[model samples]
Target: MKLGKEYQQLTPEDFTINPEQPEDFQQAIAQLVTQSTSWHGVVQCCGHDFTGEETSVSETGYGSTLLLVQALVKAELSPLPRLWLVTQGAQPLDSHPVMSGVVKSSLGMVKTISSEHPGLRCVAIDLDPQQTVEEQARMLMAEIWSESREDEVAFRQGIRYVAQLIDSHWTQSTLTVQQYQFLQQIKTASISERQNILRDYLQSEIVQVLGMNHEQVDLQKPLNDMGVDSLMALELRSRIKTHLEVELKISKFVEGVSISDLATEVNEQLEQIETNQENNLDNEEQINSAEGNNIDWLEGEL
Candidate 1:
């Protein structure tokens, strides 16, 4: 198969790969692993020849790449700062059965690895064959160095598409005028009423973040089990702190904690803070009243 102009343009420094012999392939990988030791971040481009049909050669190639990545991860003395997997397929990579199978399988593996090794900051990039090698290389390099937290990126027909998952929770410390008025109206409401309000707020936030409907979210189910990763958890925490002015530990948002439990905790903290504020204001007023009485008595004597 003829190499694409983009692939031809890539230099040895750009990427290192050897498919001729097992020892050479291992040696090239060792060099990469050694180079990665000093580098803060490493981006591995798993280039494959998509020309072949679904055959033993393609299967072995894909398996070899997977094992190499596993070896890199295992060889690292410390967790890698970031790991990016770049896979290229001809235009409509998903349409070709052989290429699609490999890409999909790779995607699943990367996603699982990302979940298991959160510190690796794993991401997958799918390159379009329609675009020039130059375009693909440029985009891939930018993504590797960019401080984007996006988990999935695709370059289709020279356009870049990024998909980021985040909670839609409002992160404003101060409520809007309308929200403030609504809260004021319900200040004298029962604890259950307040809890219900918070619960609804949290439910909406989770639904928006998870891209699901309110009915789909089980209040009692753990958020992690529902595919809420660390990034999502952090976003939720930020939203809660900003909206409710309640500081929650990161641990509270992890796997074992349910949304219902989180909402209840937030409500309790909000109530406690409000109660303390009210108590302080009452004490201040009492002190002022006492001082006024003393001043009035002194003035009469004078």
Candidate 2:
């Protein structure tokens, strides 16, 4: 361990998991967890996308990442490590609009994982791809060690920026009256209706962002194949989270997932949210009823 602090290196080989079963990934990481009784932090530098022959980013960024996160979740360590996922050009900065590769997808997974495992203190940092390796390394190392809680961060021209989804105001006065009414009723709409709305909203955003005509977007076609780069995918994911209250998976946006598939995923999230809400209400009612019975018993004793 460098700096005399307990740190652990989880290699690429250590990130292995069976697609059919998760036991190996779990056991491997559990052993790593035992190596440190309590860890100060853990850093994972997911490598950059291929430039030449293969020309694909999913295997490195998507599936393997899924495995690694699952392993960490399964390990069930007592004191979870503060995880920093470092990548080159993983996020979108205003100055640099070329959002490409699995790094961006990693950010999506980070958001989901952070919400599900708040103790992990997970964040994804995107380096300025144009900068020299030494410069990027210095900045990345500094940010990783710093006590910053910024979730998704990116560097542009030596400045750091964190991702935030500002409430969109541009939708006003742009759509027909019926569409406006639909927006007002979206939350109360049926599951199928909500899915349709999400699909329509995505289509509109894609058309506007990509400079494509209304007829050009194909819902069944993969966003990646339609030239949906990281910047576009990030924006789309942000808008979906802000408007529809669903964090669309990286696969839905990056790894050749189609618009129809995204809508279905959104619908499933909505259903899960509804189920959770009902369960909470039932629990509250039961608690209240028990409290009332206890009060009656105390009065009878008096």
Candidate 3:
């Protein structure tokens, strides 16, 4: 399967980056969305293993980042943020930055750490699955030019958008009812309450939705440390939306936050929801009891 074709078929927007110029690629991505200001940088991890003969890049255990960036350019997500990836022994660094403006993963690092001296095991990888390369660039321009608040919000939206995009490309599954309800709580809850609600529901839903043991998705730990990447976040976000029937911004509230915090937010919102429901039920019961004693219908018929 070609990454570009697959991405084009599965995704709603065009995301293409400069095959030759990483900087151009970043600028392109920022343009497609809103609320984004500037990109920190971009790094290509070791995922860019693509062959000219194939329609999409092969997921052949290495170098898929290039294909991903290519897709971004094609899709035209503007304000392309910077790119980052590990340095392959053969990578052309003079042309590409050690890390692009946006965050990135280093597959090379993963390979290196696998050896006896596994020191640099923990690293972050960011991918743009949404707008094209041009769009990403536009997003950057808008961000750089916009005010601070505007830039922050835009950046939040951009990452969230990218998370959703990646999720769409990677997974295809229907959501369960519980996932739906949990999503609703996440959307309306206040920041404090949302954290509580997320914690309560995430614990229950991780197994049901992600098919992992409770121990695997420990909410007490940080997401990056838990081995959760942008793609996983995207998958989680997608499932939550599918089940919850609402679109939650993965980047705005979910990104860079610890699983513990998320779980806490979820729990708080859930508690509030339960409280509200109970209050409504109590009011209904009181009204019913009062009406029962009145016997107005019987009196009128007689």
Better candidate by lDDT, 1 or 3: 1
lDDT of 3 at 191: 73
User: Tens digits of per-residue lDDT for model 3 on 8-35?
Assistant: 2223234533343444444444443334
Model 2: runs farther than 4 Å from truth?
1-24, 50-58, 94-104, 167-302
Sequence-dependent TM-score of model 3: 0.26
Q: Model 2, residue 275: what's the lDDT? A: 77
TM-score of each: 0.41, 0.44, 0.26
Every candidate's lDDT: 0.61, 0.65, 0.42
> Taking the tens digit of each residue's C-alpha lDDT, what string does model 1 give over 81-166?
56677777622433434455565565676787666555566787777766688767766765665444567766654445554445
Best by lDDT: 2
User: Sort by TM-score, best first: what order?
Assistant: 2, 1, 3
lDDT of 1: 0.61
